[model samples]
Target: MSFLRSLSPLRAWRDLRRFLALRKPHEIGFMVISFAVTGTILFALYKDAAIPPTYKRDVLYVESWPLSRTDREIIDQQKADLIAEKKRAAELRARQLKRQAEFKRLDDRLERLGI
Candidate 1:
């Protein structure tokens, strides 16, 4: 136990000297900078990967409207009916304009006849 005690003090002193010798000023500075840079990069990556809890919302159940085959057929028929109605309206307007021009020509003829 006495021998062990003597060896431990010497070993501790040797270890201390070795540690002090290995830590040069430039090496210590480089280690400090490297650790700071690694810590910063890891922190940035962790923050980027983390999801914010404030944005989480509650889920809601939604009911959908059911469409049968007959309903789809009716919708298609209505679309066709609307297109036909639009075409009929356009034709009616064109005929009305033609009749108005004919009426204007008749009025001009009556004016020339002084009636």
Candidate 2:
């Protein structure tokens, strides 16, 4: 009980009061800057919460229509182009892999021949 009495709330309050009273100009400036930054962050968060996302405004829950014949033909043409491009890419990748394997085989043969 005596030890607890020695470290009382009143003493801590007084110490905190004295520390605040003894703040220098630079310390006061830093404290003001920190408060301003925290206020700006809180204001930004408030603004963000008030506004809805752009996607919700533009696209979400919007009605869609089925394609017309011309639109469907255009989409089919685009799909065929994409499939051709993918096939070309796969062929290029296979050729690259084969070239790499051939280089490795030649390197191994050169090493075996001590050259």
Candidate 3:
């Protein structure tokens, strides 16, 4: 019986009214803004958690070529891959050499300063 009385809608509304009545308008505005921000964040999190993804997965790194490619095509692809790999290696090597040169120059400067 006591639990049922506590659950009454009229009492709940009265309590809510009393609580709101005690709050300043600016406090209520801040509370409303806080609730809006919190609700927006929760909604965004819920959307991000959805199954089957609302957007495509990050840059799918699968082969775009057909499975029944010709042998010559495969050889060409291998050649292209080797060329690209060599190009990247050459670029990285150049960068490394430049960095080493800079460090050597700094070392020589420090040696001249006798530090």
Best-matching candidate per lDDT: 3
Give candidate 2 regions above 4 Å deviation: 1-69
Our model 3 lands, by Cα RMSD against the true structure, at 12.5
Q: Write the per-residue lDDT of candidate 2 for residues 1-115, one digit (tens) a residue.
A: 8988699889999999899889998998999899999999999999989986533233447545455658777789789979988997898789889989999999999999999
- Model 1, 1-115: lDDT tens per residue? 7886677777899998899688989988897799999999999999988967533374766745456558777789789979988997898789889989999999999999999
Model 2: weakest 10-residue lDDT segment is 54-63
Least accurate stretch of 10 residues (summed lDDT) in model 1?
54-63
Q: Model 3, 1-115: lDDT tens per residue?
A: 8877679788889999999999999999999999999999999999988757333354647788998899999999999999988997898789889989999999999999998
lDDT of each: 0.84, 0.86, 0.90
Q: What 10-residue stretch in candidate 3 is worst by lDDT? A: 51-60
What's the lDDT for residue 69 in model 3? 95
RMSD of candidates 1 onward, in order = 27.8, 17.2, 12.5
Give the Å error, residue 48, model 2: 67
Model 2, CA-based lDDT: 0.86
Candidate 3: regions farther than 4 A off: 1-60
Rank order (by TM-score, best first):
3, 1, 2
Could you tally the backbone clashes for each prediction? 0, 0, 0
